[model samples]
Target: MRVLCATALALAAVVVPALTAQAEQPVNLGSTQIVDTVGALGGQEAEVESALNRLYNATGAQLFVVYVATFDGVAADESWATATAEQNGLGTDDVLLAVATEERIYDIFYPSDFQLDTEATREVENEFLPLLSDENWAGAALAAADGYREAIEGPGFPWGFVLGVLVVGAVVIGIVLVIGRRRASARHTAELADLTKLEQRASRALVHLDDSLTTSEQELGFAVAQFGTEASAPFVEALEAARTKVGEAFRIKQTLDDGVPETDEQARAGLLRILELCDQADDELDRQADAFDELRALEQAAPQTLVQVRADAERAAARLSAAIEALRLLEQRYSSAAVATVEDNTEQAEMLLTFVGRTASQAEGAIAAGKSGSAAIQLRTVQASVAQAGQLLDAIDSLGDRLAEATQSLDAVVADTRHDLAAAKAFQAEATSAELSAGIAAAEASLAVAESPSTLANPVARLERLTAANQELEGTFGRTRDAHTRIQNARVALDGTLATARGQIVAAGDFITTRRGGVGETARTRLAEANRRLDQAVSLAGDDPVAALAEAQQANSLAGAAISAAQSDLTSYQPVGPSRGMFTGPGVSEAVVGGIIGALIGGRGGGFGGGFGGGRSRSGCFGALGGFGGSSRSSGGSLGRSIGRSVGRSAGRSSRGRF
Candidate 1:
């Protein structure tokens, strides 16, 4: 009974919607020994009818059979069979075998006190279900009739009918094998095409990175000549590291192009390796290029750059007051945690602006005193401070917009969560598992909180809560859903997840760009990785949405870590003194130099490595002693009450499932 309940729950999750949609009016069997709605028994209908008549004569138990395209909106096969049986006034000695051919489901139902209990009925189903699978419909019907006869009158098995079924089954098996082969061939062709595209992409990336490296090498030479070896050493090291990666990529390419044959998996791995190496090389080169560009700008136009920094500082100062006012307004409407990310943004911006002002004054004095080296250092400090201040101000200004988007997303996810709860309830109605019931109750409680008016004050947190609750509910029935349903659910969730990921990535990227002076290698590395993953998610969204959703969620998490790491780095950062050297500044490591340089030189140039590639009836002959029967029962009884009772109780002694 427990097993039957669980199986019903599992099948109910998947088949309910389909059953409900295709449901028609109740079909009344009404003394008909055989009702083949779709002609499932073919030309042997009379033979199957004859067998049923023989079973009735040998044992007074009547067997009523009904075949339809589907259960006509009934939630389960057992329920449909029971309704049809009772609707035709089938008595204590009667049995009903109902088949929904299109759905590949059938059930055998008899009175609870009938001679054939659950185990006996299971035996009856085992006799005919295999023939049903072979589409020997007439054979299946005959087998069922014989099974009932054997149960009542002792052994008289039909070996002749079994032999005929075997012949038909062999033909079906051969056809299935041929179809399987064709599908296998199609899959192989698709794999080959994918491999070819990957290889081509890797080759293109290798060529582009190689060209960019060459150009970067020339730029590194110019920097050394202009700034001397000590100042240019970091760029030199960065270029060497990039060259090492590019060289490795070339080796993989050469191996791939060699005469040595490789398996498709091996070739794919090699191609991916090539792409990975190329991306690493480009990142290394760009980091150095950015640092080099900053050095060049400072050295060539210190006075002009100092003027620009001052102007930027003045503009940021003007925005600081407005940002503070906006934060205060937001604070009144939301909780501290809701606006915590930007609560101190205005204060940070004001402090940075003051630091910039002092630094700029000192830089001007140094320039007046004809101390070029000291002035360059002071100007660089002022430049970085002004940029950080602008970022702080921007953060405060953007918080309201982010909150608004979160509120909208919260609404959408709440609706999705409710839909999940409805499905879980449907499954619970069929099986009533304690675990499933607890999950549904928990999710419903979460939804109650999430839908409260106060939840709007912290919409982001509410969204997370609702999403988590929905996920827990999904886990309860995740294995029960068909692949198509699972994929469709993923696609629906993906849009919001991707939007969240993109928003976080953009915010983190802007922080890194403006405050790179304080951000360290780890944060920058994570940010880059997040961007790569987000690109991959977008590319895979149409074809593999489950994978895409995973990737997007990962990107969101990584971006969050990047934001935390960058914020921590900024808080602990100390402005380097002029004594550290003209080129050295806070947060500027060798890898950072390489990243900046790579960006300056490769700036969206075309080529392969140009950017991150987003990657039955049995007929029995009538027995000689078989006699025909007239109508056995009136056809006036309603199926509604019988169906209601079946739905109300746990399934009883029945053998039921898809063929």
Candidate 2:
């Protein structure tokens, strides 16, 4: 604008004198009227007359064929024909001048209100409109004016020039606005291009993500399929399944940018959260994989325990497993005892009958040898023989009864013991010899009892005086053993039932906490209480047979209550299948193997059986009966020590193989 104004001022100064010189010149238009569109009113008539004479004096606008018309009939360039227009410095588009002669010509330009358009406007030296630069105008194309042959010129004025210049000013402003708009449009175009590129990239990433997710899902499915199949103890397969899931999840997460940029940070944060979840899953999978690796490594094993390594972790299942093994050993021991008793009874009955027969022969020989004088003595000896025979019969009968009772008890024990050991095996399948000894002691009392003649005797009557005494005694013992087994079974059953219930309570609490924050406190408290109950149950559930049964029932009831409460709290308690898997305590197997060894070396009475002496009456004190005298027929098998040795040796071999 400043440049335009300077140009306008320079042009105005040069044109002012030319116009003054041409002011008196009258254009020969052949009689036509012309009204100025922009000037000082009709003063244009006089002003043009004066300026034309002055301008024509100095320039060569020979003949002008000016056409006259109402101001409305004039074109925008008519502004230049006005008197004040030249003084205001007209622009190229705001003014027009035409010379009506053999050399016809025209010119046009604009003049701005700000007086700034003058610089850029092209100008001509001629006092007339130059011949049209378009090259198409002809002298003959001009129409003759009205019939008077008189020279005519229009009025020049400044009345509407301001508004005309204002219009021109608006045009320049419009140009500026248009330029600014185009700049904004270019910016918008560039932004759109960038956005398109980002969208395409995001789309590609999404496609890859979809593919990764699909692959991960398939891997996870395959892993899950591997679970609960033919996998043996330690279930290495489960670990494998989890490992696959974690590994895939990790890869899926790694594809995302770990160093999130600040741009789109919320979305980046969401991606990061997903990555964390993937990491957690991956970690869990790795753990499971490690577990399986350990388990698979254990498939190979050896058969016996070396002295120094007998109690080592690898030498046995380690703790609870050892206890379970011990209980199993106890069953084996008692069963073996029953078999031994049966064998002993068979042998004892034969020996007693043989003694009885020998005594009769002795009695007959004595009678014959004595003659009349020794007859009475012989008869007394014969009576003594009969009494001895009855006593032998009674002893045989008692032995038979004890054997039957012991056999029956052993059967029941073997069955229950098998089941308990299996349960413990699922939880923890290893322990040491010492642990086995403890489990065995818990399994049966009589198996550990030292033999005593007083406890063994039923001395009220002679055997010959009783009918089916052996059968009767056997039945009695069997009944007693059955009763004791029933009680034990009840207790074990109760413990299992309650443990299951307590597990349900813990699950319910976790569910509630996850689902509903409002009920979290209450649910957590309930879960804590339930956990305490379960812990207590673990301590005493198997202690008292009857109490264990009650505890089991209570545990079951609590489980239901916990589940119901969880559902009420969060509406999310759902039954899970095989939901609870028993945890194998880290050292349970080692303890079991240890207990077994303890039981073997220091049996219940603290001594090995069948020492060196002939059979003697059983004693009650630990290590007393086992000192020199051999054990009686009522001995139990020491299965714990044997099995412990086997499992322990296997475990040891497994460990050494790694070395």
Candidate 3:
């Protein structure tokens, strides 16, 4: 019975994973001609879709255009496009063009029985590649459509085949060939310029990685000395892996630098490889550095941290009575729903403060007994508890202020919303659509609710409802608005969106900062990207409020994602058992090592440096926001840096090449 059960379990495990994989396969757009998931075509999606549909009707050969972020972890662009085509039951009569905007790569897929000849296919790709390289996404889609149509229709009868016409045509052809040669020369020059820039970038990345590795090595030595070899094994392993990557990067650079001729493609590939290696090395080093920093802080800064935690706890405890009083007052003035978020905040604060106190005492005992690892863990717990307690107390204290602000802003917002609704109604009166009518109705309902006396008790909720409704109305009629008016509206919306994005980013940063022990690269990367986007939003707010609004929204999304990723990481974190032969344990050793290395490296902050935003440059801390460039960084693939491929089953014939 045991053998039978074991066999069944094994089979189930294999089958379950297979089923899951199958279920997760990428979905194909059966009839949709344009899939702009990344919004790369902006508002021109309809225009592009129309062109593609026209081409399909004209030639009976559908051309599916897809734009995505980064192929969603797919390794090959062609494979992904081919898989989609196969899934859609497409064959020689159809083509799929998949573009990953973030990765800056694209592929064209068709079946073996594809209608177009090889030259025609090449011509179609040529038509769009230049536009794509220029980031003219809409233009590229249109160009592709036109190119396919032209290929299918072919040139009309040679009317210039008469004697005199043929002579004129010959001269024209000669002139065209000369112009083409000149253009080709210009293109070659441009390509070389781009390659040179990539080469320089690769060199800079290599230097940065090399410097990081050196600092990490020194830190690793200190860690080993303090914690012993066994405890510092992870860092050692990470350092070695980083070194290996650096070595490969250097080798590639050497080959490129050697006094030997190489093709432009070859050199570009080498440079991209160097950058990829550096990126990978940096990621590995950053992860280990974060862990090391946490370990070091607990061991070396335990006393100070413990004191801080205790101080915070005392302050939170002191505020508990005031918080309770505030909540009581709010409850009298507001409904249960309005005060519910903070009703139990005071009690929770009190309990957390008590836990902090107990943890602090245990941590002190552990510190005194030279059990630094245990002390560090206990100190971290105390810190977290104190922080939570402070948050709870603050929520109680801030609720009334928040409500007051919402109430104060509600009247003005309501006025603006009414004005917007008037404009929407005027537009709807001109030519009413179901979408516009629905939006107008929703706005009216939301406005009515916002003005209700009962809803006044929850001013924040009312404000949110009104804001959302107004936004929907604006979206519905935005295209009809004059450019100036649209910009004015966007300016009004941008401020609130920016504020919300900033708050979310700060909250996520705080969470990750406090509980970084379990946080991984994904959270850090998202946080960095959020900061970068926020910065961009701020910069663009004056001139391009609409773009700024979009950027702010993206920043808010990224921040939320960061928080989610961090929470997941923390949830999955598993503590390792204590290692032998250390002063306090592995934790203490890591702290010591981190401190020494940080100092040796002149306390240069870790994690992507200030390239993200104007964040602090703290050693081993999530400081300098801009260094990693997050999703902005070029992820090297077959087409070189910043290029990506899609992952999908190999089911159709396709040609993959770089733009």
Candidate 4:
């Protein structure tokens, strides 16, 4: 009795737990039109039923969407859905979609009549999973039902239905191709137009600057002449110098206007040069204008203030010395040309300082001798010297800034060149030329030299050399990249062109079927010819890309002509000129042949370069050239005279650029 009691307890322990665990598992809602054992559908059950019913009526395909809290966490949702579908006696045309909301898992099962592959399943999941994740039970069910309808109603494979399927397929592919190509072409055209507009904008700026400078010179000449004293001589000299620089700018502008840029390189170089020259001249003219304003103030000063004038001259001379020293230091770190400018400018400034000191001494002697007339003349001379020294100081103080700006510009170019070089090198790893690598190396060395502290004493030379080397590197890298991209795009174009041509031919076949009652014998003959041409294109696609493109073009042309004829037969269309398709000909035309030959001979293949060339102008020259503007000027020298001088309004801020 004791042994039997122990055995009964052991059996009870196992059986009770199994029964309890089964009860804990999610309740299996009997297979119905829409099962929601988890109450996921809630208020949307009617909507789900309506959608499934409509889909079934339209496509003879049914979908069952079921949601449960969990499939016991062990059995997959797919297995459950299969069992539910089978239990419900769902036919081969039915599709089952099951979700275990709590477990965050879902699965879809396609019946025999609904063929599916990995791609189709992936698409279905992509569409339905998001809705499920959002707890959109009704939406998920409707989406599943819609997907099933599309799959069933979509073109199917069968010998008897081949014509209808092919015709529909061709029409759909044609629409996609035409829309895609048109969009791509529009984008490409916009890009090209933008580049053209950049060039135009630069040209317009040059012209405006030229006109403004002309007006500024006239105003400056008038002011200098009105001052009419030795103090005004420096202002006059500056005005002449500015005029000369402006003249040179005009010559460059004229050169740009004389012809359109033959190549991208030529265009970019010319446009950038125009901008640089115009900016330089603008700066020079601005300095001249400031000097004139100062001179006008000095002219109105009283003769009794000779002492203060001498003191002002002395202070300006000291500032001039400090500025020259700064330039001498700047020379060490920048390019040679930049340092040379500093050296030349500093030398002139020193000569002016010596003049200022001599004039100051003469004015002091005159004041001691009590000759006010002589003192007035000497002080006026001092004021002119001071003004000249100040101009020189302005240039010196800005030298370091200009050098930095130029260096930054070159660095940007170097960065872009290297990026392109890396791409080209990657594409042409074994084919990379020694010259390209050498250019890159030299550019790096130049940049290093420019950046080194040792070069600070002659910074201008290093900066100039670095700029030149980087520019050269840019040219080399650009050509290499263009070649690589051209080849790649050309190869891609072969496939794209063939596909587009085949699509057009298929569309023509579709058109014939849609208008079978209206299509005449001529339309049929042309379509037959188009089919033969398309077959030839396919046969040649592997061996000769160029020939294949030509054949494809011919096929596309013939198909279009046939479609046009069919349409004319359906309606009373007035006869236009001879029907000429995009590429009308029995054989490859001279232009097509020539284009292929040129692509082969040019050694750059074809297409709009690559990622580098696609929209380089938008980021290259203009973005790098921005951020440089005129420096603010100090208040006009504190001349003792309270003369009211009207400083001419600046002719608009120099250049307008967008980042």
Q: Name the regions of candidate 3 deviating beyond 4 angstroms.
A: 1-264, 279-305, 328-348, 372-377, 412-444, 455-457, 467-659
- State the displacement of the C-alpha of residue 120, model 4, in Å, after optimal TM-score superposition: 60
- Minimal lDDT window, size 10, model 1: 608-617
Clash count of each predicted structure: 39, 93, 11, 19
lDDT of 2 by residue, 424-461 (tens): 33323332233434443443333222122233322112
* Least accurate 10 contiguous residues by lDDT in model 3: 636-645
Q: Superposing every Cα of model 1 onto the true structure, what RMSD results?
A: 37.5
Which model, 1 or 3, shows the larger TM-score?
Answer: 3
Across 497-610, the per-residue lDDT of candidate 1 in tens digits comes to 999999999999987776654455446667777788899999999988988987888788668767866775666544333322233468654224423433333223311121
| Highest-scoring model, TM-score | 3
Error of 2 at 99 (Å): 99
Each candidate structure's TM-score, on Cα atoms with residue i matched to residue i, is: 0.34, 0.16, 0.35, 0.33
Which ten-residue region of model 2 has the weakest summed lDDT?
650-659
The better candidate by lDDT, 1 or 4, is 1
- Show model 2 residue runs off by greater than 4 Å: 1-476, 487-499, 515-517, 520-529, 569-659
Rank order by lDDT, top first?
3, 1, 4, 2
C-alpha displacement of 595 in model 1, angstroms?
98
- For residue 247, give model 3's deviation from the true position in Å: 7.6
State the RMSD for candidate 3. Answer: 37.8
